[model samples]
Target chain A: MYNILLFAKRELRVFVDTPVGYVVLAVFPATMAALFFLAGSFFAESEATLRNFFTWMPIAMALLVPALTMRMWSEEIREGTEELLLTWPIRLRELVLGKFLGALSLLFLTLLATAMIPMTVAYLGDVDGGVVLAGYCGTFLLGAVCASLGLLLSSLTRNQIVAWLSSAAILIALNLLGLAATARSIPPSLAHALETLDLGLHFYSMSRGVIDAADLLFFLGLTLFFLVCNGLVLERRLRR
Target chain B: MMSPDSSVLAVKVQGLKKSYGSIAALQGVDFEAPVGAVTAFLGPNGAGKTTAIRILTGSLLPDAGSVHLFGADALRSGQDLKKRVGYLPENNPLWPEMTVEETLAFAWSAQGRVGHKMSAVERVVVSVGLEPVFRRRIQECSKGFRQRVGLAQALIHDPELVILDEPTNGLDPLQVIQIRELVRELGRQKTVLLTTHVLPEVEALADRVVLLHEGKKVVEGTLAEVTSVKAGQQQFKVTVNGSEEDLKSMLATAGVTRLESGFPSSSAQASAVVLADGGQEIFEAAVKHDLVLLELAPRSGTLESLFYGLTQAEGLHV
Candidate 1:
């Protein structure tokens, strides 16, 4: 656990030290704001709530989170530093969790910057603080899932572009699972399973102010699943 | 030639074998390095030197072999035995995105040490002379500086065993000397096992030499034992300044067994073989013939020639 924190701090410092890290942080909020205000109709609604703004976050993060996590393992493999990392005394679990939470911490801080949206809406009119808090929770879980999936793909290759493209494809496929399950051509049993696995369904539910235990478990479980896959990939490399 | 039966061995390998796809990287290689000695692993490209080191360092698993480092089974140990062993791989890799200080700190912490990390970082930085570039990003540093940084991180933990694969691969001659000095210093207290193509490096620092060829150990012993007198083959270069007929008659009477040439021109470059303990007879023959010997240098084996001879299968160069 201590090893995880040490590496997490190292990863956070990497974000600060590099100009790209700051660029990612800055551009995410701007793009999220643009998609929130310009792309959607927040002013069109009577209620002064950030529901529309929070609704589009997971879709935007489908692109943004990969950008943040693409270089996590891709760059390490490309630079041959993975060899050193693999041989170090640190456990595979420590290294994976460290980088995962590190990316998540950055995701949290970036979300923190978006607090102005909720604060602005609250100042203008009455807003449900419960829904707003739940929105942040859902977005955080979605980002963790995206980051873990991104890290797993990063472990597949040394090319960040490949990691980015492959992770984006998987995230898009995940968001479409519920729609696929709704198709009349598919069997009901398989459709039900697909609906249960649909990531967007859980993310949207949490964003709409409903933090069901099942919904929370869905996102957290998916994140853990990908992280475990990432760890297995790294462990396999050691045997090679 | 000699294994320390009483003293502890820092590294021991037996029947080590590894294959990549259809290519065999190592084929039943075996060697051991005792404590506090500099052992040079000499071999040509694709000679299993790096593969052997990787297995010893616990970074790669071998197909059929056993490796013991400091009495810990490399194949079975689970508690990060590598923290006690330092390894600088063939192409030393570092985080180019991080500064030199950050890189060293990351390496130090990766070992899971609890004490203040910077003190150990400072110690290695000084030991490797990396203070000047402490704040420079690794991408901004030169190749030599990057190699030094690689060495610093490997040494930061003060490991009991140091494994350097081609430690002086690419560097200026002076930088090579500096690294060699640092490695020799480390050898005084820590067992240093290094692989280098440079024969002078072996001569200057290695107390023992393990030469490999085509993924197998051809020889392992003291430098002198391997490079000195092969067997009963006595070779010498003689330059006699006397008439050919007179030199021949003198040599025949004085027990010089075989001359490369039936008749020798006085003072010409020629090789001669004498009977057992017959070097004295050659000198006596030269004196009896009144030959003014310009050169009488004895031709003995050198590491360079021995390496070439041992690893001459194909594509092997010094």
Candidate 2:
């Protein structure tokens, strides 16, 4: 447990010391705000809620989370520091969890930065705080899922670009699975399975102020699945 | 080689085997490092030196092997045993973006040590001479200082067994000397196992030598034991100003056997190998036969000659 925190602190320090952290911090909120205010329907319906912000959240996270977590394991392998790290007196699971939490923390901060959009919506007119709170909760959970997936892909290769692209591609596929076009082209039963597996669909349910147990379990289960797979990949490398 | 008592051995491996796809990295190799001694691990490229070190340090696992460190089952102990062993792997991998201070802290904390972190960091900092670059980012430091940081992290928790792979690689002569001095100092109290291609460094620092060839233990013994010719016989190269017949007869009278004769030269100064340590008797025989001895020095006993002879033998080339 102590070693886990040590690794977590080291990961956070690396993020803070490098430019990648600031880049994500700036790019994520900027893209989310631009899509919400300009490209989204924030003014078309004249609603006093951050519904458009929540709508654009998953897309923004899909692009930004991969960029945030791509270097977590890939850079270590590229620099040959994995030997040093793995040889330390720490378990593989702790290392995986610590890095996952570190990336999740940064994602949390990125989401926190966009709080001003909701603040602006509240200042302009009446806004339901419960829906806004649920939206933020759902967005953070969605980001955690993305972070774990990005970390798993990062462990598979030493090239950060490959890690980023593979993670982004898979995430974009999962996000698009629930689209009408995708659902219509597939058979009904297959489409239903894909919809249940869609990452964006689960977040969409939570964004509407409905934090159902099924949706919570979906996010948690998927996140754990990716993290376990990440651990197995690392363990296999150690044995090899 | 002295029979290693498992109790006194800092590191012990038996029948260690590891293969990558079709290529075998370590093939049924056994190695031992005694407590409080510097054991130089020498091998040619692809001789499984790094692979063996990785397995000992718990960075990698072997398919069929048992690693015991300080009388404990290292392969099973895992993290608990790792705290007692410090490893500076080949190439000295480190976080280039981290400051020297932060790297030491991370290493110290990774050991799960309980104390004032500053004091622990300062101790290694002083030992490895990392004070000047303590706050400097690793990437900004020179290769020598970067190597020092690598050493510092390995020693941060005062581990009992220190494993260093090519510690002075790519350093200038002065830096090499400094690091060798530090390694020699470490060997006084801790069990030190280091791998190097530099044979002279082994002669200068290693109390024992282990040579590997083709992922197998070629030799393991003290420096004198590894370099010695047989049990009681010694070989010497002698340059004499006399006929080959005269040199043979002279050496024969001194109880020395001529192993090989060099090519006859016009200058009448030919070298021959004599298998005996009768230096005084050979000199007396040469004087009696009126054969002027030019040079008579021990042959085929230096670490360089032994390393080349063992590693470059048939089927040993990488």
Candidate 3:
């Protein structure tokens, strides 16, 4: 755990020292807030509260989270610092977990800043507090899972651009592949399985004020799977 | 130089081998570095110097053989060994974005020793001569300073053994001398294994030299013991202001074989001949020839000759 924390601290410092942190942290919410306010103001007849904010985050994160996490190990490898880090007494899991927690923290802060849209809705009308709270919880958890997946992919290659593009591609396919409502002829079981893989299915369910155990389990499982893979990738390199 | 009665062995390897695909990097390399002395890992480029260092430090596992560091199995107890071992790789990478102070703190923390706060970090920085650049980012520092920071990182935890590979690679002559001094100082009390192509470095710093060739231990011993050939029968080089034939005849009269000559540059005919079995006898012969012996000096006999001699004379264990 101490190893993980130290890794996390180092990761945090990387963010603070580089321009990526400021650009990502500030731009994410700024873009989300602009789109949310603009959509809300333009569509006066819309009945739902803060739907615009929650709706855009999934799409925004598909590209953004990969950009944030793909450099986690790729940079280390390219810089030859992997040799130094692997030589340390810390286990592979500790290093991976540290990076995961650090990247997740930054993503968490970005997501938190978007909460202003929900707050604005509550000020303007009778917003469903329970559903709003659940939506935030779902978004945060799903984002964490996506970040972990991106970090794992990043660990696979030293070229940051390749890591970002591949991670984004996988995320886009998973998040958008099941949303063809027009394909009504598809079998129910297969469609449900496909929807289970979608970020929207689980996220939308939570946003409706329903806290389903399976949905939370899905996000947690995805996060753990990718984190484990990240650990494995590092293990291969450590022993070499 | 491990005592037979002593239970602790600094490093022990048996049949150590590592192959990257078809190219067998290390094959059947075996040796031991005992506790409490500096051992020089000497070899030329592609001699697997860095590979051996990596394997010993637990950064790289071998394809075959076992390594024990300080009585712990290197393969099984890798993390435990790594905790007790500090390594400074050939080209030490510093996070250029970090200040000298920040980098030192991170290195200390990376070793899992978090109790060392700012003051302790400062002490190491000062020891490594990084005080002036404590606040400066590593990218802004010179190459010498970067190396000092690398040394500081390796020494941060005060590990039982310190492994440095080519620590003097890019430094200027002055920096090289300073680093050598520091290494000599560190070696007085710690077990240090440093790799270098510089033969004189081995002569100056290493108590014993381990000559590696093509990933195998070709030679291992104290400087004189490893490099000295025809042991107990000394060697000499002589330059005479006389005809090559005259010098050869003079040494021939004394019964010297394997007579060799250096290129005649300008006014002098310089020749070096070896007496296969004579030491002082050969020296006396050169003096009596009236050959105007311009220079006659004893060959300090270095790991370089041993390395070149071993690689050329016979191929190492494949």
Candidate 4:
């Protein structure tokens, strides 16, 4: 626990000390906000509510979260700092969890900055505060899952670009898995299996002011699975 | 068998082995490093010196061996054991993102040590001789200071045993001497496991030495114990200002069983004299003949020669 907190503090310090964090924090909110306004004005039929704003996030995160997390472990290995960290009296799980939580905190802070859009929606028309709260919960969980996936992929390679591209590819596939329902000939069982893994379909259920136990379990389970895998990979490298 | 008082063995390795697929990095290597002593682990490149240090310090696990640190099983609970061991890898991986003070504090706390406040960090910084640049970001620090920061982190926990791999690799001669002195000072109260190929370093600092070759322990003991002179294989160098032919004939008749010479024609002061056996008899005869000997001394074999001699003699390149 102390190890995790120590490392997490260091990770946060690193984020604040460099321009990379500021760039990610600014780019995600700016790009997502711009896309939301453009789609609302030119393409959508009605004013953009928190639903429309939340709908654009997973797509935005597919690119942004990978950029944020690609350097978590990969850069450490590339710079040989991983050896230093490994030699310290730190358990593998604690080290991984520390960095995971640190990255999650940064993402959450960036997500918090976008609360103005939902607050703006509340002023314009009748908006269910429960749905808005659920949307934030679902979005945060989705970001958590994405960040863990990104961190796990980042652990496998030292090349940050490779980490980014591979994580983005995985996120894209998982996000679009439910959309394969367009193939009319596809069987229901196979489609259902794909939908269960599809992050987009789960968020759709959350956006409708409904939070299913399965949806929450899916995100939590995926995050835990990837984090465990990340820890295992790090343990193997340290042993080697 | 070992004792707690007289034999403060900081490290004890037996049947240590590690392999990466088909390549065995360490093979049945065993050694003992005593407490409050500087033990140099000498080896050529790829000779598993770093691998052994990593295993002892809990960074790498051995495939088939047992390592005990101060009599505690190193493998069974490495994290618990690591608190007692400070390791400096070949590359000093100082965190560039943090200042020297911040980095050292983070490392000190990581070892589960409390009271490593500003005073503690400042003490290590001053001890390693880095007080001038404690506020600088590590990325901005010079290589020597970076190395010092690495050393400072290792020393912050004040571990019982400190293992340093190639600690003087990048330093200039002056910095190397300073680090050597610091290490010697530290070794007075703590066990130090230093690795290097430099012969004089081991001779100057190490109380005991282990020479490794091809991932095996070739020889390990006090400096004199490994390089002691024997009757048949004694070695000496004699410098004489005489005719090359006369020098060779004189050495041969003086009971110098084997002699090899490489003298330059321009300088009579230059002459090569190698005697394989009967060093004292050859010296006495050469002196009696009134040979204008420039210099004569035993060719003190160093850790470098010992490493090359043992490794090459064993037909192992590394």
Ranking by DockQ: 2, 4, 3, 1
Top candidate, metric TM-score: 2
Residues B226-295, model 2: lDDT tens digits? 8876445566777789766677677767766655564454457667766575578778988988899988
DockQ of all predictions against the true structure, Cα-based: 0.51, 0.73, 0.58, 0.63
True contacts kept of 3: 0.79
lDDT digits (tens) for residues B1-318 of candidate 4: 111233767789999999878999999999998777788999888999999988887777889999988898988874878888888889888778789999888888888887737788988988889988989999899888888898899999888888999988979998889888888778777878899987778888887788888899988887776665422355566677777665665565575533334446334644543535546666676777667766677775545555555666433211
Give the CA lDDT, 0 to 100, for residue B199 in model 3: 82
Top candidate (lDDT): 2
lDDT of 4 by residue, A1-240 (tens): 887887777777788779977886677777766776665552355553576777786787788778878998898988888888888888889999999988888788788777776766666767788988898898888888989999999999999999999999999889998888657888999888888899988888787679999999999999999999998898787567
**Please, what are the lDDT tens digits per residue for candidate 3 over residues A61-180?**
888889888888898888778889878888888888999998887777777766676777777778888888888888888788889989999899999999999998988878875785
3 or 4, greater by lDDT? 4
Best by DockQ: 2
A159: Cα error in model 4, Å = 1.1
| Residue B244, candidate 1: C-alpha displacement in angstroms | 22
**Clashing pairs for predicted structure model 2, backbone only:** none
- Runs of candidate 2 exceeding 4 Å displacement: A180-185, B1-7, B230-300, B315-318
Docking class of 1: medium
Instruction: In model 3, state the lDDT of residue A240.
Output: 60
Candidate 1 lDDT over residue span B24-87, tens digit each:
9999999988877789999988888988887887667898989988888888897568888887
